[model samples]
Target: MKINKFLLGAFALSVGFASCSNEEPIKGDNGGATDGEKYVTVRINSVGDIGSRAATDNDDFEGPAEGSSEGNVTKENIRFYFFTADGMPFVMSQTGVNGTVNTNMVKPDALNVSNTNGDEKTSLEAVLVLGAPEKYVGNRPAIMFCVANATDEAAFEQFAKKRLDAIPDIEVNTPGEWSKFRMTSSTYKEGEGEGAKVIYYTDISDNVKDTKDAAMANPANIYLERLAAKMRVKGLGEYTVMEKNEDGTLATAQYKIRDENGTTITALKVNLLGWEPYMTANSCYAVKNIDKTWTNTSLFNGWNNADLHRCYWALAPGIVSPNNNTIPLYDNNKFKYGNYDGNKPTENIVYTYENTSYQPASVTDRSTKATAILVKAVVKLEGSDEGIDMVEWGSDYFTLEYFKAIVVEAYNADKDVTNQATAKDVVLKKNTGADARSNTWYATVKGDDFKRFSNISWWQNGITSYFVNVEHLGSKYGVVRNHIYDYTFNNVVGLGVPGDDPVNPQDPKPSYLAARVHVLNWHVVSNSTILQ
Candidate 1:
């Protein structure tokens, strides 16, 4: 895909050379030129298939019938040739069969042999101009003839006159007896695959006659006629490009089908080309329901369902991250508050115990849900970067904002508390708290309330340390240690009923819900005194 500058130049040069060589020869003015100096250019017109049928078992009658079975009909081998006014014999060139000949550098035996083979050889009429090296100017008429053996002479002559006669025309006895020929006119582009050959035939003209005898008398005319016949064959069988009557839409053309008589049957008003667009529109409508479902249900909720995830997983690999955290376990037996010695604790004492129990709350699923929503939003925004925005705010800033949003969402969802905040907030706090001691902090939440503070830096930082410790502690001890701190008496305290009763009894709420409950032990203690 990456083309070097030098190679590109070389390719361009090669293309130019090929283009120059492929250009069709233009006829020059030959006024008053001598017969020896005359020149002409001839080109191929068309090609087509010719064949005969043989009887086979498929056409046989089941019971004993009078007629024999007919075999499947197929086209025979195709032939191609060119038609031109130039008298020169057909010579295969790099571009195509050319008819122009160099009279000045004539070969020893030029035009010396007769074309009376009547089978293989053919000839054509060419303009004759007489001229010496410096005096060549005008052109004159020259007789056209072809050499073919006994078997092909008659057919070849007939073909030549039908094509080269002053008024080119043909006559058809029956519709099925139409003569076919190939027609090609367009110039080939450089580096393209081999040139295409078009086949067509002249429709019958009532006035034209089948002069087989006259064509045979003049053999050169036969060659010209055959060449013209080859050029007129239509290769793209029976095609039409129709325009819609109502709105100018392009309609498909009709195609030729075989009739019972084993002849090509041309159908009128057929619409073959329109089928593709019709099928495409139908398929879109068929899938309308699936698209509606995705639009109606929020994309975030749909993604969370395991089934939806599996579907997406099959469609696009590596979409879901591999490192999702497992759900935390909760303890049902642990007491929220410390046990008292009194047989019946006073109201104040009970209230105090209740308030203390609410110090720490358990983690909730809502936190995970919110984080999942944030991640989904980030991904969605990222996906829309390629779309056009109509708003005046301009697309560049929105593109930058999209990137910023991803980073912000990811940082906020981190278990570490320090990194949790909008970019603006992080910048302001960093500036204001420059003098304060800075250290890598960690956090662990005991109750469901962990969801609310999941975005905080302290928790995210703490999770990292906990993860590292668990890995170093190995499976046997890691699980036991996690059980103790992850679900203990202190951790489960604040997860119960509200301790404080609101003045409005209906709004019963916890008075002192504990934000977090975990040991804050750190291996690398910061030296705050040394910094001061």
Candidate 2:
């Protein structure tokens, strides 16, 4: 068996380029072409540590050689590699006209080249050119220089800038005396130039430490660090940074969104991906992870604005009437029956009805005639089939017959009952149609009936003409739910209780006696005169 030797130490410039003839080239079975391609070569001659004291001493610190220490003090050389829009690689080579090779040579196609100046060194220049001119166009190839030293870091940066500016079509814009330069090409727009962006790594003393701290402290810095860490882990070379900016506050930063591919996105529409409560009071809150590695099986789940609202609501205390004035008596146990006095009413009212078991014989007699008459008139105008039960008069339980009797009695009491009666005309027409439930009932009742209901002193005094008609069927029959009622008659004349429930059984044909209670005094009108 024969062994093939691999050429490992050959320099990129050593690749031999064979002269081409006008004859057809031969092709190999393994797809190797007989023709050869030419490539550009760049060279850099670094003068070695010019700004260091070691350069002045002839002592060889590392070796016994007479000039070893002097050589060690020479400037350091750097090279960069670039590819055309098409896939082609080139190495930059460095060559000095007056001195020996002290620094590392530049790569073949590197556009930006830099070297430090020694104390003894008066003038230093590097020669670089593309190896293959046929492969490129006008001003397609260029070079940049960055000079730096352990001391006076800004000097080398300035020198580099001056050198870069000397090159044709290269312009530097230093806006605020900032040490950075914005290099623009005369041939192209702001960011479209060949060497559009160039950064000088002048200070390396604490570069690593500073970058590490930034990565840990700043989100944007962390993002860069993560990218760098990924590059290292994946062994991916030639990674470039496009842009970075500070986040809203130093605490939390937002990066101009990116796509999966490592391309710098220029134009994008950023709609807040997560909930922002500070932006809107009604806004909900949510949690988001940056890694994007979360799966359905992960312990972390996505939340929305609704979830935030739930959290706030949970922490918030129950709505306590600002002054016991805004809340209805129905909610206040002390005022279980009805107490609008300033002093805190006694809790004794809470168990009064429970122990008595004695229901008010007539919810509305001559004594409470004004209140009863007003309620009946309102119910008639409301066209509420589920009549007011004893509950409306402050009873807890309802018998089917009793509920029906209350409705019959209220209907009979209406002296001027008319066939054209409808709650819409009487109650709803007067108020704004902003609330759906209220507007619906108002639109349904007759105008005449609404007027009559709105005119009754007691009903007008206690109940608002504008009331919402809610359906109480099934499980919802006995459950009191809130409704939006507006009163236009007087500022004080508002619906006492905003919640309502069906007095009769919703199903089973009323197997047991039931009564609908239109609980009164639940919500009071703000500016009503009668209630005040």
Candidate 3:
């Protein structure tokens, strides 16, 4: 059985404009009538568009599918922060805010922008008072950061106080830690995406006029990115057996199964049960980060959007220490599972922190890990009212009773007699050796101890599971923040690996699942890449 999966971003970008009056400036303790105080109005875009060709290759993009654009780009609120050229928090005139002198953080009310076309594009216009303006008399402030819809002011207050480089290193213990907090660079510099969203004052200094009216006319623009990545699964249609022709085209074939008597069963059915995410990260950083030394530079071809200065790679939490072995299998919020037949709109869509690993040397290597989807499915055969529970060995499938019976038959033939008990012992050894007469290996025809003797996997109720790795564009293995991974299975080659253990799944046999993939840049509508 082969499974084809596709990765798509369902959220598209739209354009909405909001503005703040320049007549009034924030004359608080931080930026009052201080001699060095300077104020600038910034036009902020909190949503990402599929048409921007930012961090994606979709230049001629249209928009997202109907009803697919949810609350992806809606900016309910806004937060503003300023930093020095050296990447430290600009000290505020007050001493006791957020436990630091950086009382410069601003929480503006939600703006009511006109969504003329109902595209869900949200924007914010805020007057950012540059403290110690005299310090940057002729020069521009280093950069500014914008956050949207961050409701937990107390939790995010800690993050807002940290320096730029330190932000990405901060650990978010759980996936639900302040869910709506978003961070994006104000300036897209060379190494900007790796750390903080640094919107450089120099990059937009040309618009930093002395007066608020002058600055508002040509204000700086910055895009905010969410700290989490989304994943969704849909049953495209009934599962089919697919094969490649000599010309590289695909051909469909019906799957065949044989009964105990070796009679081919013409009637077979496969059903889509449910799915869950496996090997996913338990935590992540507040800001996205990446490894600069990754040798596969091609993996990053479209990773960085020149227009937006956003990088797609984020080093997930626990990746640095390499203790990401434990998967939260029971966490309903993160490891979501739901029943959806093929082509249903009710499948569960979940979010995850960025998770990645170095490309393993072999298929069996487990030292490094990446996030993969655990698909649960069952196969039904004719004449069997229940799903068939079978075990696979070498290249064939058999029920536990049938498998043991075959071994017993071979043992009796070798001994030239049906010694029953004597032959059963040797056949149960899980492995056959030179000492074939040993009567120590014991196994019953039932489920209990037989599995201990045989190394074969046992599928319960014919439940076959496939662990499909989530692929990003290029050769890298990981899921990045602000992107959506949509998976659709296209083929199935064999009875999948036995057992329904989503936590620790066995490696699939060669070609058990076949895939073809395509990744396009994100823009106005939800973007999708195919994995066949």
Question: Best-fitting candidate, measured by TM-score?
Answer: 3
The candidate with the higher lDDT, 1 or 3, is 3
- For every model shown, what is its TM-score relative to the native structure? 0.13, 0.15, 0.67
TM-score (C-alpha, index-matched) for candidate 2: 0.15
Ranking by TM-score: 3, 2, 1
TM-score of 3: 0.67
Candidate 2, position 509, lDDT: 12
Per-residue CA lDDT of model 1 for 310-405, tens digit only, reads 111000011122112221212122112222212322111110000000111112111111111000000011113222111101111122223234
lDDT of each: 0.17, 0.18, 0.46
Among these predictions, the greatest lDDT belongs to: 3
Clash count for candidate 3 is: 39
Order the numbered candidates by lDDT, best leading. 3, 2, 1
Instruction: Estimate, for each residue in 1-532, the C-alpha lDDT of model 3 and write its tens digit.
Output: 0000001222111111112123433333442221222345455443344335433344322222223332333323445565666666654543112112235455533333333225433332223333443432233344566554444556457657667566556666443543343444422335433553433222344544555555545556555565556666655333543444668555553444333677353544455466666566766666656655432364555555546555555556555433234333233343346632334432465566667655544322233567766655666665455677555554456665566666556544544443443323433323234532111233443223443344455555665555566677655667776666655555654445543232333344432344433222222112222222
